[model samples]
Target: MLTKTKAYALKGLEGQAVEIEVDLTPGVPAMEMVGLPDAVVKESKDRVRSAIINSGFDYPIKRITINFAPAETKKEGAIFDLPVAIGILSAYDQIPTNCQDGYVLLGELSLDGSLRKINGLMAILISGLQNGYKKYIVPKENQAEASFVDGIEVYPASNLSEVVNHLSNVSPIPRLETKKFNGKNETSKYGVDFADVKGQLKAKRALEIAVAGGHNVLMVGPPGAGKTMLAKCVLTIMPDLSFEEAVEVTKIHSVAGVLDASQGIVTSRPFRSPHHSITVPALIGGDRRAKPGEVSLAHNGVLFLDEVPEYGRTVLDSLRQPLEDGVVTISRVLQTVEYPACFTLIGSMNPCPCGNYGSKNKECTCSPSQIRNYIGRISGPFLDRIDIQIEVDGISFGEFKDKASGEPSEKIRERVVKVREIERERFKGSKTRTNSEMTNEDIKKYCEVDRESQNLLELSFAKLGLSARAGFRILRVARTIADLEGSDSIKVEHIAEAIQYRSLDKKYWK
Candidate 1:
């Protein structure tokens, strides 16, 4: 007898349909799974066998051959355990096969037949729905993740016996109701607030512009100048992610297995702060399995790199492609995976190795050669991609002890949301979400500068010897500044502030 059940195999963030076909033939008692399965899929046979007997079902003594088709792609993960077990049981005439259609089965069966949650359940469920499969049988623990997908009947089962009971029409398991996820209430609110930072009005203004334009920023200052704190606070001031953006960000986290299972959907903009010692592959996304790296995990949010120059040259340089293309494509020998990396890069570094090179209260001990070499770790091309560069100074003792609080993130966020709305209206019917994503054509179309601003920009271009990419980045920043003030055209002051940000590169690099 032969039976077939539907399942899915994940390749990167997408899912490919896999049909689990089982054949029960009269021979020596043995089991085999074919079709390019990895070690985990092959080992499912033992799990399924033990689960079937423990669940009060007879393990067929016939030779059972299970095949996962299409026969070319390699299957990984234990998600195929349930479908494979069902296929074998149906082949032996223990359960009906008609119930398998229009349903996708995925779960890891334990030795005692209890269903265990598996990673990438959301992506698989979305893929199944996209492919016209509306019914899903997943582990009960994964019911929350699967419920995020609307228009689907998600039936979660606790053990193999429950699934069999449902299929046999003896007891029908209730389908889970889709609940509207409230990200605002579920998001964490314990992080650093903008009001906590004592004083750095200049740095605060630069961050507002950066968030408004979706531009990358770099801050240079000594330690304890609130660089890290300011970076953390930026999350609160930035505009919230749209529903589509949240889904994209959540999918990457899901694939990377970093998502919180209890939080069904990601609500807040992601903030990823990887250490400076992270590898090139870890920053850009590459490994044996081609898992998502920090950049991908920061999709539609921020990628904060503190002590930026401490990172290896190769690691910092790897960010150029994803910074420009808004995606990272990692090509392995077996497959090519594309991860969405549309994130705002916020990097912080000291002026020199001693971190007191430009401090008012401290004197630097590092030589010119050492300072040059230290900054040289960051390549010119990488530095050129950063849209805003500002130097932070330590707050005076008086400012630190001041009783007055700075502007709250809620106030800043309101202005940011307004600026984003303007950009949204400006870029309607287009792919871009902010001014930083604008191309040269977009600059010409939307970022038109008056005669005075053009003259000022030309002079700064000549004095700074800025590259054409740097020139465009300046225009993008200026446009964002103008947008923040509810201006339709870039003004001279906006261009001047943008030019001020560019001067830091020359100061540090020279």
Candidate 2:
């Protein structure tokens, strides 16, 4: 007898259909698995046999063959265990062969016949839905997250026997009740707020603009100048995630195996702060399985790097391509995978070796050579990609002791949400959502400045010796500033504020 069961394997962030073909014939009592399955899939036979026997079913002592069809895509993980076992049981007529004709089976079965939770279940289910497979049989442990995927009849089963019962109609497993996705995710509650920070109004404003326009930011300051605090407060001022954007963010997190099983979806934006010692592969996403790294994990959110100059130059430089393209592609010998990395890069570093090069109250202690070498660790090309580079001076004694809190993040987020709405209307039906993502064609079409603003841009390029790319960046930021002020055109003040951000490159890196 031959039987087939439907299953799914993760291909990057999307799901690809996989068919489990199980064949049984009268011969020696041996079982073999074919198709391009990894070592884990090859080992599922033992677990499946033990599960079937333990679940009060007969494990056929006959020649058995299981194939994860297509025979090309590399299949990893134990997501195939339940499907393989189901196919085997169907071959013996223990369960109706047609029961799994319309369902995607996903789970890992233990020797005791209990089903355990598997990774990438959400990714597989969502991809299956998009590809027009609306029914799924997932592990009961993953029922919460599975409930959020609408239009899918998800049957959550506890073990192999329960699944077999559901298939046989002796005891049908109840379908999971779908949960409504709220905009605010209750899993990750953030207590940090902008009002908690003491000072650095300029840095706070820069961060607001960075989040408002999805631009990258770099903060130069002495130690304890609130740069890190400002970076952490960025999410507080960011706009709320839309449903579509939330799905994209959740899909990436799910495939990365970091999704909160209890929570249905990810509503809050991500904030990934990798250590300075991170490797290129770890930061940019590369491994034996080609899993998503920090950049992809921080999709639609912030990638903060504290003490940016202390990071490895190679690792810092590796981010240039992902920052420019907003996606990281990891290629292997057989398959290539891509993960979305559209994140805001916010980095903070000191002025010099002594960390007081440009301090107002303190004198500089580092020499020019030390300063140059320290800043040199951050490459010129990397700095060019950052749209806002502002200096964060330490707070004065009077300002620190005033006991007056700055503006709350809630108020700042209102302006940010309004500006984001403007961009959404402007870029409707297109992929361009923010100012930093605009191409030269977009810049010419939407980021036009008047004569005075153009003169300021040109003078900055000539006097500061800025690159042509720098000119485009300044315009993008200026357009963001204009949008914030409800101005139809880029004003000179917007141009000046945007150029002021670029002045740090000449100030420190010169």
Candidate 3:
């Protein structure tokens, strides 16, 4: 007898349908698997067998063969264990074949016959729904995450017996109740807030603009300055995640196996601060499993690299492509997978090895050669990508002891949300979301400046020796500043303020 069961496979963030086919014949007792399965999938045969026998079922000891259809695509993980076991049981007439039809099975089977929760269930179920698969049999442990997905009948099974009983109509498992998606149900607090930081109002203002326009920022300061604190406070002032953004972020986190399954969704904007010793693949996404790296994991959020100059030049340079394209593609011998990496970059760096090369209150000890070499670690081209670069000076004693708190993050977030709404209305029915994501065409169409602003920008470009990319970034930032002030056109003052952010390259890099 031959039987088939439906399953799903994950490749990067997308899921593909896989048909688990089982064939049993009255011959020698042996079992074999085919269809480009990985070692984990191949090992599922023993697990499936043990689970079936241990679950009070007769194991088919005859010649058995299993294949994952669409053999060209490589199948990985133990997501197929339940489906393979079901196919075998259905083929042997132990369970009605009609029960296995029209359902997608996804879980890992233990020797004790219990169903273990698997990663990427959210991605798989969402993809299956889009492909017109309605019903699913998932592990009970995944119920919370599965509940977030609507328009489908999800049967949460604790073990193979429960599923079999439910399918046989002896005892039917209740379908999971769908939960409504509320992106802002969870509070948007990150413990650290801008009000806690005593000074460096300029740095705080720059961070607000960076988060408002989704532009990259680089902060230069001496040791003990509030650069790191300012960067950490960025999440507090960021706009709330839309339902679509939350879903996209949740899918990536689910596939990476880093999601908090209890929450069933990610509402807060992600803040990923990788160490300086990170490798290229670790930051850019490529390993044996081709999992998502820090960039992809930081999708729709902030990717902060503290002490940026302490990082390897190569690793820092590796981010150029993803920074420009907003997506990282990891290629293997057989396939290439792309993960969305649209994130705001926040980098903090010291002026020199001594951390006081250009501080007004501190004396510098590093020589010119040493300062040049230290700053040289960050390439000019890489600095060009950053839209805002501000120097964070040491706070004065009077300012630190004033006991007056700065503006709260809640107020900053209100302005950010309003600015983001304006962008959304401007980019309606399109993919562009923020000023940083605008292309040259978008810049020409929306970022036009008056004669005085244009001439000022041209003069600044000539005097500062700015690259074309740098000039365009300044224009993008100016557009964001105008949007913040509710101005219809980019004003000369906005252009001047945006130009001030680019002066650090001349001050430090020279």
TM-score to native of every candidate shown: 0.97, 0.97, 0.97
RMSD of 3: 1.6
Candidate 1 wrongly placed segments (more than 4 Å): 185-188
Give the least accurate 10-residue stretch of model 1, judged by summed lDDT: 181-190
Q: Model 2 lDDT vs. the true structure?
A: 0.87
Residues 272-339, candidate 3: write the lDDT tens digits: 99999999999999887888999988998999999998889899998988898889999976678999
- 289: Cα error in model 2, Å: 0.5
Expressed as tens digits, the lDDT of each residue in 1-510 for candidate 1 is 888898898888888888988998999999887875457755787899999999988899999998888986646648888998888888888887666767789899999999988888878888878988888898998887777788889989999999999878789999898877554412147467778888899999999999988989999999888899999987888775666677787778887888888776687888899998899888899898899999999998899999998888888889989998999999998788899898889999998989998899788999998988888888776887899999998999999899999898888888988998999899999988799999889988987888998898888878887777888988999999999999887889988999999897667774
- Which residue runs of candidate 2 sit more than 4 Å off their true CA positions? 185-188
- Local lDDT at 162 for model 3: 96
Q: How many clashes in each candidate?
A: 0, 0, 0
lDDT of each: 0.86, 0.87, 0.88
Structure candidate 1, residue pairs in collision? none
